[model samples]
Target: MRLPRSRRRSETRDVASDKSEATSQTSLPGDQQAAGAARRFLRTALAQWSDSGLPEAARLGERLLDDSTLLVSELVTNAVVHAGTTVELVCRLDTRESPPGLVVEVSDHHPTRALRDDSGVLDESDVPDDSREGGRGLQLVAALSDAWGISYRRDRKTVWCRFDLPAGDGATPLLSLRGEPPAELIAPVPPQADRANDQEWAGRGALSFLAEASDLLAGQLDEDNVASLAAQLLVPRIADWCAVWVYPAGAGARLPSVWHVEERRIDGLRSVLEKSPPAADKRPGARHIAWPATPGDTVGGGALAVPLLVTGRCQGTLLLGRAGPLGLPDEVTGLVEDFARRVALAMGAARQYARQAMISTVLQRGLLPPAVGRIPGIDHAVVYEPLAGDWVGGDFYDLFPAGDGRWCFALGDVCGNGPEAASLAGVARPVLRLLAREGYGVCDVLDRLNKALADEAAAALTGGTAAWEGGQARFLSLLYGEITPYAPERGAHCTLASAGHPLPLVLGSDGRVREAASPQILLGISETAQYTSESFDLSSGDSLLCVTDGVTERRRGQRQFDDDDGLATVFGDCTGLGAAGIAERIRHAVHAYDSAPPADDLAVLVLQAR
Candidate 1:
């Protein structure tokens, strides 16, 4: 099987010649459609190279090809979603190296939208929450590629990943072309070193440590979690030991988390820190604390304590200790202080959100009707589901007695969500009740409310007061009605006024559903907006249903839950059910239409003549 010397050298040269470089570039629009096109173009180009007798083609197995296509798809999709500009993709096969490599570079014109962490891999700490739908794209790219990185220019940014091809005979296998190995290939085990070295303080290692620390801090909202994560990030990275002390509002300081590279020495270190003298000023600042050069403590060079200041208040203190002769460097000190600042900010936000959520809950409960009171000869049921978050929604419903033998009910939706919407609902609910108690009819009550809202809006537009700035005025759709019991033969009569709200559905005892009133202009839009009342008779066992648009507009993927025909069908199915039964049926159906939590507030009111 031995070959001649000249023939062997000729074969080697042929293989090396095949390693010559080839590159292909294409520009695509920044949109969802471009992802598929970019994938197709990449596959086509790679196939052409395979057919050209390139030596690297033999190593392009199915797994590698599929991974390349997937990475291309993810990167293109990221560009489309985040950049929103023309994207340029350059794929290059560099046969110049022994094993050769394929470099895929995706560039966008948006420099400001560059990735937060230069490290291509996005770990759990980088994402805001576990339930987040997006942000896993970069993680996929890092997993599939042998190496990846981000580069920035003045007006553009490029994300590049490299895939190495297996070497041919007489060709040496090249290591990863990029300096850093893939994050997945790196072992999860912590470093064995008890102390950080000068080498670990430079370049990618230091930068990566800081980036990961930032991500961890950003992801956590709880003060205890933030403190623990902050301590964990400092230990085995910049310090031999770390301890965090938190000072809650109107409470004394407490140590929540302590970490040390040597697990056995953690208790001793904690004791030393606790017994140590307090800092000179004890105010919100950072400084170095001197420790005695004892036997076990000789290696522990010095300690630095930095205050966690949030909104000009000292919330906590972060203490760190390093080993060996080197005192903390200026750069390291600055990095530690920056980390403390991030922790403080996160803690502040978490506390503020909790406070706001509690306030909103209390206010919402106060604004809503406590219970649906029993009106003579009337049976009713109401359902309210607020949007999932730490804020109240704009939807509101109330049923109360107006006067003798009359019960007034209202269902309305403000134009927005959150605290502003809740405030407006608070004002509207009481105003409606006051007007009704003053003996105003349905039409008269709506007219007065509309005029009041319009005047407020006009005053806000004219800068009448600072309190009326921004969201002082808002639009709302309302369905207001008063029910009065007649005689045993007639049952009850309902007088209703519709102000741009969804038409009320009247479910007849014989299984027919019809609109109770026509729509009108929404309140607060026009000063001259006219509203009129319509009268309807509710026979025994007949139910009137009023709802906010949240019920009708609920979506399953791309399709809505209830159009006109669908609503009618839903009503038709509830023919023999009582008011409470019918409301439950509709609520359950709306929830079943989509697996995801509803994005809007839902409110439903069902009143039946008994």
Candidate 2:
């Protein structure tokens, strides 16, 4: 099949002409098709440029081909999908002294236009699972391309992309249109000619963007902050225009709820659902619909609704949409879902704080005794820590001024925790304070409290025999103390009463520690239970420390407690630290002894003779 010389040259010229024509034809497509074709064509063009060996452009050609082509595709895509029209793409093979690359621009006829909003475009609810048909296109382009956007004109809009192709001796581009680019855009010089540096550069850039996004999300604190973070992450990363809403854990199927929004209106977005809510419900708290917008109409276009959910519960929904069909990618959707969970946790914390504040107010007012009856030379400071649980625990301390110059005080822990225990303390506190002021000793006060509790228990179950037998019975442990400050000639005397409770620690001015004298039966155990009170003399600078089981019984391991020995070590090792210091040491010791933070309410009362 030998041919004549003329025919052979003609064949060679035809082949060359065909390749040139193919390359030229790659540049001429409608905007939509051009963007897609550009991506496909660029990948192919990179391979061809590498093999065909334009040694100079080929030396830096791979890098230029990858970055320039990707940016070209993005600009073309944005111009086609968002700004509207078949764009004009211009790519100049730029070669100057320093290095070489490409300059690309895609222009469409649209002057007055809108930009992607700062919020995300993926509807929280419209995220598709891994086995789905679409998503993640523009997001990928945003990740890969260096810069992409649209420019305005009197008769048209020009979408443009600029890729700073790095300068590597083997494959990086140093400069193209002008001289050397700034240091930031300059590519690193290649270490080896055989190595493919451009692919590595692209990979590193993508990874850097992802790392930045991860760091941004890691530092968030509250639920609202999470939504805001999601919005921040999604906006240029995905499409634009995002909104997120979260429901309280118990807010299912309820209106007048809390929600977060980036944009308030998506005309017809709401009406579509209002007109057909049941149909929307089929997707389980999510719905998506898109319709083209006619000129002058606010409704229609791209729209998506997604649910913020955890454990199969619909906590809230996310609404995202744009005027055109900008695909909602799964990566963006997954990000929003993750942010939704954090938002839920943050809201839960806020709710707990509000609850704690309310209970604190009610319990503090209801439980502490009225002002001391003008007792002389007696000062008091009380501290109470509630268990970190559903309700505040029953721990109370009080100093009542009994008309003389002496003050009577008591500190006690009710058995169990929560409102029931707190209620018992509420009933017993004022009564015991009044009885002590009326000249009753510790034993008499105990007797009065026990009888009153029994009577109240009986009254609480007025319904039936069953209610009286099991429902209305409650028991408690208590400790009470009183002090009489003495003048210089007299040592102040102190008295304490314990019932089925830990001994209170007493620190003498001479650096000695001792337990309260005697212990007795807990309140509500035996109606006729006898109580004993121990008296000790307090010198100037001497102090008494009273506490509940919360300090001693804090669990450190599976079956370990910071027991009496631990408490003794804390009090005995006291190093001239005053009352406040001793209290602080005990608190610190408890914190250290426990494997985790102490879980129960802790109450401490300290008295130092002036």
Candidate 3:
């Protein structure tokens, strides 16, 4: 029954007493018959190896023979099914180990195709629960092979496996979680005769695998991404398939990611796994049991499910499934646990960031007014924008009636951005409204707000358990104004003060622009500072323009939007534009000043006489 390397080996070597290592290779056409030819080839190899004690092949030849032929059948079937090209299979007795190892390589011409998904259905989408797939062949290979991996050359792709033909049966490869495993695990070493060289190959493959897994998992900042990465990282590389489950107490469990080695069966696998969520295991070693948490597996259930533990908490569970009752080797199970720890850490970090962002969003919503109030007899417009990616920023604006004959408006910018500056702005806006409605003038409101901010800051700095010690802003630039209109068609009486804010500009109907308020010290600087209000007549067809530093300080290399009186020049050009027209024109001009977006928060307001 022996087939030659070229069908030309002498029949003398096939005798029962032959001790030389039996090795042969063959090329089969890319067709369904390839698997049968491969199985027949394995039968002949085992028959010739009957005399040699390569490992325990002589004593346990019958068991090894059955497993090896099945392994060959599965590997060659996959090549014919997916690659659909000529298959080059090599079967050899590699004598580099304690006894010796049987190395089988099944290669095909197609190399770059994606590893087939067995279920074909992926993710959490609905799929038939009992749907079948063409992955059992791989399941058989997974159950039987000691160590296996895929390799690629320019001309073909090869699936290779090594069988440590069981020595003495005293404690075998299908070891307990604490038992020792073989040394050379999937290392890329050439066949040789030195036993010490086999030991050198041990650990390198595992270290490289974990290092690459870390590189991919470390940069992920989202919980779902952590789950997805962890599942995919285990598949094909370590496990035949994997699923990641993240659940919290009092919350519904989520199956975020699933992957399988065969390119087709992803959906069927996901459906089966979904029906039986693994119990939350907080143990040190992987719980070797059926893992869809199901009663039994059609593909011979042997899975390791363990909690993803970090900081004494279980963020999720990771399940790695193999083909047979033989779970992962002892070393690999430890590796899986270590991998779970990193995934747990990443998930925890992502969740923390999400909570902060949500809180910031709610706080930001409370700090700003719902809508700008309408002003009587004054054509007014307001522009407000925050820096991108910031939930809350330093800049704030408001336009509201003070419940009398006068309407008040304010715009301010704190020293810095984020929750701290947002808190300051949040406090200042409500206080200004309260003071103005109580009959305080524009300058009076500024004075009171300045005292409140400085006092609060001082208290926080001097006390333990202070809320704003690390996050408080040191300064705020503000512009406060009050408008009283006599007639709908006439100019209004305006009183305003600038607290280290941009100077308000009045653009005349005659094309002349002039400053309406003078500069003063910023609030939160001095509690004893007295402020003054400037009064000016806003005549018909004249526009008043106000903005924060985000507008005036917008930069283009060495030049700013307001450099060399640039803002004034831009305002002067808007001769007779209405409130909204002037506000939009100036906004456009500021943005056009540079090709890049503004680096700070922007706010603009404009008012024109009827």
Compute the lDDT of residue 484 as modeled in candidate 2: 83
Compare the candidates by TM-score and give the number of the best one: 1
Q: Is candidate 2 or candidate 3 better by TM-score?
A: 3
Per-residue lDDT over 308-391 for candidate 2, one digit per residue giving the tens place of the 0 to 100 score: 554565545555555456344444444444544544444445445666778867876787666544334433345567776546
Q: What is the lDDT of candidate 2?
A: 0.55
Q: Is candidate 2 or candidate 3 better by lDDT?
A: 3
lDDT of 1 by residue, 1-610 (tens): 1122222210001111223366788999987567666766776677666667766765665445546666776677677776789999988786665456776778888876332344443444532332344223565555556666666677777777767775543121122211221221221224434234434343223433443355456666677888887787777656777888877777766777888877787887777667653432336656897655323655447778898887678777888876644366676777778778888887777777667878988988976886866677888899898888738989999999988778999999988888888888889999999999999999999999999988888877687653243454488899999999775435799999889898899999999999999989999999898899999899998999999988988888878877656766897899889989999998998988889988899999999887
Superposed by TM-score, candidate 1 places the C-alpha of residue 94 at a distance from the truth, in angstroms, of 6.6
Ranking by TM-score: 1, 3, 2
- State how far residue 60 of model 2 sits from its true place (Å): 30
What is the C-alpha lDDT profile of model 3 across 213-234, one tens digit per residue? 5545666778898898787777
Q: What is the lDDT of residue 597 in candidate 3?
A: 87
Task: List the candidate numbers ranked by lDDT, top first.
Answer: 1, 3, 2
Best of the candidates, lDDT: 1
lDDT of 1 at 574: 98
Q: Which ten residues in a row have the lowest lDDT in candidate 1?
A: 7-16
lDDT of 3 at 595: 94
- Which 10-residue span in candidate 3 carries the lowest summed lDDT? 175-184
